[model samples]
Target: MYNVDDVVMYGTFGICKITAVEKRNFTGEEQEYFVLRHVNSDKNVFYVPTDNEAALSKLHSVCSKSDVDALISHMNSEKLIWIDNDAKRKEEYSRIIKEADYHEIIMLIKTLYLRRKELGAAGKKLRSSDENYLNLAENMLFEEFAYALDIERREVVDYIEKHIA
Candidate 1:
């Protein structure tokens, strides 16, 4: 139930501004769609069905700076769980990324970051799958954080470090 010009977090697409809510008979039946324009990319646009609750469930309002701070603070006390099985770990990572929950995404990023550091200290490297999910989680979380906190994308890591250090 977002209105025009409302900014929302649309799953992995990151921050999107609702440009319009229009009814069109694209499938031979009149249906409403929320036209979203990606805030980070001018050429990217998305049309989400207005009545689809499952899809709409993924649309979350942009969090406030206080919310971001709270989430980061919470992360300091959260425990990291690492799955040893690659297949299961990948599936779990995919689910967390797809769900795009702020806390869960932070967990994924924190877990992978620690894992990467551990592997590096042992003279090893992250498995390709782990690396990919880490990057995806970081990108998604940072994008939302940047838009919400009014900071540049590149500054997210440093911001998090300063806040959580």
Candidate 2:
């Protein structure tokens, strides 16, 4: 259970704060909902039912700077299992996104980055869908990384590069 002011990563919403937790009878029965506000926005808000298991699955604790450091170092040897079959690739990537695992998200980014470079050298490009996935993964990662490290989102690439170097 999260309390007010606690920062958390909520699925595709990226970093958010638990602004409030109130019990209401909106559905004709009293239930609790977690009121969240996006860290980057003041107007955007979300209400997540506290008792909803499926929705709660997407809520995750924010990672720390050390966690980010270790992850980047580990990424040096990790590889993305490229699925040649389009359907399988899409399905697998979709599952990873739904699962909202930063480790897998980083792997996805690495895989696509390498694949894009390989294709670019061959005078080819990734399928548009793969490109979109890359963008999505990067956004998710950058948001969390920026929040965790107290850096700007644009600096995430340079940070990772410095670590990779």
Candidate 3:
């Protein structure tokens, strides 16, 4: 259970700071929800049930700068797997994004990039769902990394571009 002011990853919502925790009446029963505000978009807020399985693990800044450095160092080498069917790929990518795992996000990004490159070489354009998934994955990862490093999302993007290249 997270307390007030705790930052947690909620599926695809990315890093959210717990602003409040209260019990509200729901269908003749009382349930607890965590009021969270997005770290990147301060205007966006979400109320999550305390026991949602989609709410995987909590991310804490236990790693030192060297660990972050190592993660960055390995960013480019991450492998991305491509699914043949668009619908199935979208569903799978959506679930993976919601899990909010850093390594998973890296895989998504790398996969998308490689897929795009392959399609480009074949004189084909990326599908709309592919574009959407790429954007979502990038935003989610950038937001979390920005919060963890105490930097802006743009800075995180710049750092990733530099390190991944």
Scored by TM-score, the top model is: 2
User: Top lDDT: which candidate number?
Assistant: 2
The predictions' CA RMSDs to the true structure, in order, are 1.3, 1.2, 2.9
Model 1 stretches with alpha carbons more than 4 Å out: none
Query: How many clashes in each candidate?
Result: 0, 0, 1
Tens digits of per-residue lDDT for model 3, 3-39: 8887766655677788998787765878787788876
Please identify which of the two predictions, 2 or 3, would achieve the higher TM-score against the true structure.
2
lDDT tens digits, residue span 1-165, model 2: 778899999998889999999997878999999999999998988888999999888898899999999999988788786899999999999888889787889889999999999999999999999998899889988999999999999999999999999
- What TM-score, over all chains together, does every model reach? 0.94, 0.95, 0.80
lDDT ranking, best first: 2, 1, 3
Q: How well does candidate 3 match the true structure in TM-score terms? A: 0.80
Q: Taking the tens digit of each residue's C-alpha lDDT, what string does model 1 give over 15-130? A: 99999999978789999999999997889988899999998988989998999999988888777868999889999999998888888888888899999999999999999999
* TM-score between candidate 1 and the true structure: 0.94
